[model samples]
Target: MATLLVLGFSSGLPFYLTSKTLQAWMTTAKVDLATIGFFSLVTLPYSLKFVWAPLMDRYTPPFLGRRRGWVLITQVLLLLVIAAMSLHDPRTGLKMLAVNAIAIAFFSASQDISLDAYRTDVLETREMGAGAAVFVMGYRIAMITTGALAFFLADRTSWNNVYLLIALLMIIGIAATFVAAEPVLNDAPPKSLAEAVVLPFADFFQRAGVLRALVVLLFIVAYKYSDSLAGSMTTPFLLQAGFSQSEVGAVFLGVGVIATIAGVVVAGAAIGKIGINRSLWIFVVFQGLSNLTYYGLSLSGKNHGFMVSAVITENFGLGLVTGAMTAYLMSMCNKRFTATQFALLSSLMAASRDILVAPAGKIIEGVGWPGFFLITVAMAIPPLILLPFIAPWSSDVPIGAAPHTGETIPARRPQPPLAVRR
Candidate 1:
C-alpha cells in the first residue's frame, strides 16, 4: 500500500506540471489563451498510452525485474525532463516548452502503464479495494501539491524555482523504486512483440467470449458516465449559482478533500466485507444520486450550508465509486497481459470522462442546471440495469472469480462462460 501510494504520487506529479503548471507559467509570461489552450494537446499521450502498452508487456528491463525496471527508468526520465523545463523561458522558448511538456507527458503516461501493471500484478484479490484507495489518495495529494501548492510557491519565488523543487520531489519515487519488491509472476512475459500485441486482445475475447466481452466494455464506459457528465459542469454551476471562487476553492480543499478521502477509506473497508459487486450497487447509487445536491443548490441559490453539503456529498460519493470501479477493473485483467489489458480498460474508462462528456454543454443548454443534474441522475440507471447481467447481486467473487490469484503458468484462468443463465 505504501509503495502504491508513492507510485501514485509519482504518476500524478508530472501530469499537472506539464499541463496545468505549464499553462500558469505561460500565462504569467504574457502568453495568449489560444496558445495555452493548444498546449493542452501535450496530454494526448495519456489517452493513447494503450497503443504502446504491449511493448512493456513483451520486454522486461534489465534491472529491478520487469515492472520495477520500467518504473525506475521512467521516473529518472521524468525528473530530468521536468527539471529541464526550468531552463526554458516560456515567451522565447514556447516551442521548446511544448516539446519538454510533451516529453513529460510521454514519460508520465509510460510510468502509469508500468506502475498500474505492477500494482495489479502484486496485489492480492482481497487487497484490491484498499490498494486502489490509498493509490488514489496519493494521486490526489500530488495533484494538490502541483496545482495549489505550486502556485503558492510561485507567489513566493520564481516559477523556475518551483519546477526545480518539484523535480527534486521525484527522488521520493526513485527511493521507493529501489526498496520496492518486484512481483513474482508464474508465467514468463510474451516472447515476441507480435505475441504481446495479438494475445492480450485474443485472450480477453476468448476468455469472456465475444458477446460478454462487448458487454463488459460497455459496462466500463457506462458505469461512470453520469459522474463524468455532471463533473464537467460542476465548477460552472457553482460559479453561476453565485458562489465566489474563493468560497468554492475553500470548500473543495477543505470539505472536498476530507470527504473524498474518507469515502475511499470507508468504501475500501466495506468492499472487503460486502464484496465488489455489492459495493458497486451501493456506491454507484450514491454516486448518481449525489448529483441531486447540485439540483437542490440550483433551486436554493447561494446558501453556504447547501454548498458545503453539496461538495461533501458529491466528492465523498465520487471517492466510493472510484474505489469500487478500480477494483472491478483490476479484477478483469489477466496476469500475463496485465499491462496491455489494464491500459485498454483504463483508456476506455478515460474515454467516458474525456469523450462522452463533450456533449454536456449542449445538453445543459437545453436542460438548464437543475434539469441537467436530473438528467445526470437518470444517466446512472443503465449501468445499474447492467449489474444483474455483468456483476449479479448474489455473487461475492468477481465475474471471473478472483483474478490474478493462485494460478500457475500452465493453468488456464477460469472465465465467465459464454451464456448468461437467468
Candidate 2:
C-alpha cells in the first residue's frame, strides 16, 4: 500500500509540472496566452501512451522485473529531464522548453503505464477498490504539491528553482521502486513484441464481442467528458473571473484538493458498500451536478467565498467519480494486458475531452463562463445513458475482473481465447 502510494505520487507529479503548472510558470514570466496554450500540445503523449505500452509489457530492464524496470527507468529519466528543464528560460528558449516539456510528458506517460500495470499485478481483486482510492489520494496530493506548493514556491523563488525542487521529489518514487517488490506473474509473458501489442485488444474483443466492446469504448470516452472539459481551462477561468493567483492556489489547489481526497476516501467506502457498478452511476451524477457549481460561481461574479464553494463542489465530485472510474477501468483489463489495455482505455477517455478542449476557448468566447459550464453538464449525459448497457446497476462484475470473466482469477493469470485480429 505504501509503495503504491509513493508510486502514485510519482505518476501524477510530472503531469501538471509539464502542463498546467508549467503554464503557470510561463504566464508569470509574462509569456503570451497563445504561446502557453500552444504549449499544451506537448502533453499529447499522454493521449497516445497506449501506442508504446506494449514495449513495457514485452521487455524488462534486467534490473527490476518487467513493471518496476520501466517504472524505475521512467522515474530516473523524468527526474533528469525535469531538472534539466529548469536550466532553460521559457521566454528566450521557448522552443527548447517545449522540447523538454514533451520529453517530460513522454517519461511521465511511460511511468503511468508501468504504475497501472504494477498496481494490477500487485493488488488482489478485492483490494482494487481501496487501492484505487489510495492511489488517487496520493495522486491528488501530488497535484497539490506540484500545482499549489510549486506555485507558492515560485512566488518566493525562481521558476527554475521551482522546477528543480519538483524534480527532486522524483527521488521519492525511485526510493519506493527500490524498496518495493516486483509483482509475481506466473503466466508466460507475450511470446514476442508483436503478440504483446496485438493480443490485448484481440482478447478483449473476443470476450466482449465487437458490438459490446465498442459500447464499452464509447462509455469510457463519455464518462468523464465534461469534467475534463471544465478542468482544461480551470486556471484560466479563475484568472479571468478576477481571482488572484494566490486565491486560486489557496482555494482550488489547497482546499479543493483536500476536499477531493476526502471525497475519494468516502467514495472508496461507498464502492465497497454499494458495488462498483452502482457507484459509477451515483458518482457520475455527482460529477454532472458539480458543473452547476461552476455556473453558480459565474453568476455570483468574483467572490472568494463563492470560488471556494465551487472548488469544493467540482473537485469533490471529481474525486468521487474518478475513484470509481479508476476501479471500473481496472476491472476492464485482462491482467495479462494490464499496461496495454488500461493505456488504451484511459487514453481514449482522455482523448475524448482533449479533442473537445481544443475548441474550449472559442466556446467560452461565445457563451461566457455560465453558458460554457452548462454545456459541460449537457456533455455528461451520453455516458449516463450508456451505463445501462456497459455497466448495468445490477451487473455483478467483480472489482478488477478479467474482461468478460465474472469470476476473479488470482495468482496465475489466464487469457481468454483471442479473437481474430481484424
- Model 2 residue runs over 4 Å out of place are 24-37, 89-95, 155-157, 232-249, 295-304, 357-375, 398-422
Deviation in angstroms for 305 in model 2?
A: 4.0
Instruction: Give the winner by lDDT.
Output: 1
Task: Work out the TM-score per prediction.
Answer: 0.94, 0.85
Could you tell me how far off, in angstroms, the CA of residue 306 lies in candidate 2 after the best superposition? 4.0
lDDT of 2 at 308: 87
Please list the Cα RMSD from the true structure of every candidate, rounded to 1 decimal place: 7.8, 7.1
Tens digits of per-residue lDDT, candidate 1, 13-77, equal 88888787888899999999999999999999999999999988998988887888899999999
Clash count per candidate: 0, 0
lDDT of 1 at 110: 95
